[model samples]
Target: MSEAAVPDGRAAPTLTARQPKAVHSALTVLEAVARLGAGASAQDISRELGLPRATTYRLLNLLVQDEYLVRTPDLAGFALGAKVVQLATVAAPPARLASAARGVVAETRAALRGGVHVVFFAGGRLTVVDADPDFPLSDAVRLVREPERFAIGRLLLIDRGAADAAAVRDFAEFGATRQLGELAPAYGCVAVPILDGAGGFAGARGFSGSRPRADDPSDVLTVLRPAAARLGPLVV
Candidate 1:
């Protein structure tokens, strides 16, 4: 009998299946702690995940012991640990931010046929969170370590005098007015501040494209301001 025609019985290869429930439970706990921002109590976790108090406590203790979570000195609550941040720094994917900004970024890319980048400020530097692939400008978009030298960061700081209170004030005013400008000769980007629910500057959203095809800085502002406004709630 041919191998294809034979009805011989053979054992199927065993494949290990992932425990999604456990993974989801851990993720739920982590997200709860992150949303609480800094310190979250066991009761808070239980309420957030709708889990039994004992189970919440047990998981919290395990996470804390494993260094994925940290217990406050008073032991009243828990927060994410340095190890967790480190792990996130290395292994965490950019799916959430990418997903959230996909529509806006796609629209900008379609309009400009250049790159659109969403950046977050941290440790006195801008970090590129996501970008479009068809951006016609240089490939500097992939350098995620620090964005201090990038046009997006510079333009975001255009009002801050690069790093001064006056500049910050200028930036705030410009953000309110929705100004646009060019960062380099061949590259121009439009930036608008992402504001939090309480109206604080969360970060900046920017769109970049080829100098030749790039719209006037003012036009860029008009295109990006609305999108940035919509992104504020997702920042925190």
Candidate 2:
């Protein structure tokens, strides 16, 4: 809050002071839910913030109505909603690549028959480090907005342990994952994870093209594996 000093040495709120107690409490409720992850019940939030149970419920209802949060499938809890993604994380600016990283991306693109892209996972966010100039991403907006729909995004989810069982199995069996005709009809993408020296996930390198190419990603993996190793140090 902003305050103005009166002639009598008393403090008065400015006419343009920002949000009041209700607004602050509402935002606090949002932060609590986000920290609790999915399936955070009203009771959980009330206890976490030490707010009155009624107040927590009221704020939750308001947030859900405004689409800033959504009830889970069973309607027992809530998760951050699409509106938050659109406002906070959508279309993050592309990250710059070092000269050596650029060289690796160029060489990989030349060897592969499809689009080659690089993405980095940091701060629980995905950033496009590089996108193939010739093929450009098919749907750049959705790539960031809906990561679950793309292979590269799945890599981040898998590393975070938030991916579905199918993604987990695919990465275990093939050391890679692919999305076939999901992002666009007859088009698909395959992504391989990059591991740092300690073998933790660093990021991912992706190849996108026809569905057939994605179905048989062995060739794509061959080209991407060495490139990922080279990029591990440069990008991380």
Candidate 3:
């Protein structure tokens, strides 16, 4: 609220160079946390960015408060927050599906009793290529922001060899991952991996239905597996 008088008697706002420095420091801190993964301590970030210990802590707290960063489960360090994922989703467009791929999705939707969705893995991130309009995902934003919450996201995570025992177990039993009443109170989902021509993980095919069907997905997997195979080359 303070101002200094200009040479011509006009008033000029007083601004400190430190303000811009603070902005730079905050961005640097966020970059450090992302590079360090989910459990990057303040000390680690400080050293990585060559910033003062006090400044690193201050920026970390501010980022967390603004939802740009979040403390790890053990509260030991930090990780990229939901806001980052939301921004990334908005900035990056999903890969366009060819006509053949679209037909595969249409056929699957017609054969399936519930929602049929497709997602692809690109740049180490999951992109929802085709979402079922008739039965939309419970929360598409949350599905991408928090991958561990949906079976489709879990399928991608399992492919990455992440340390998720539950996702691994679901894949082993059903040849897909299952999410029962997790995304929503009454709905459930199952997702199977779609592999590329070379057998590399390309994407996932997801189906959402009632809780009972999700809990016992044997019948659903029968239909999903072949569809996923049919879709693999088309999408890739």
5-117, model 2: which lDDT tens digit per residue?
99999999874444577889988987887677656899999999999999899999999899677776448887666466456555565467899989998999999967898
Compare candidates 1 and 3 on lDDT and give the better one: 3
Ranking by TM-score: 3, 2, 1
Model 1 TM-score is: 0.45
lDDT of 1: 0.57
- Residues 1-236 of candidate 3 have per-residue lDDT tens digits of 45899999999987676677777878788777666765679999989988889988889999989978777544777777656655768756647789998998898888886889888876668887777766655555567768888999998788778828988988887889999986457779999989988887798999998888899998888889999998888877
Instruction: Give the TM-score (vs. native) of candidate 3.
Output: 0.62
- After superposition, candidate 2 runs with Cα above 4 Å error: 1-94
The lDDT leader among the candidates is 3
Best TM-score among the predictions, by candidate number: 3
Off by over 4 Å in 1: 1-95, 98-100, 136-148, 155-184, 212-215
RMSD after Cα superposition, model 3: 11.0
| lDDT of candidate 1 over 1-236, digit per residue (tens) | 11233356754543335455666787789888877744468988899889999878877888877867776534677766645544444543332474666676677656654456676654444445654433422223212332333445554455344643533553465552221223346544546667767765556776665454333455666667777876767665
> Residue 209 error for model 2, in Å?
0.8
Clashes of each: 4, 0, 0
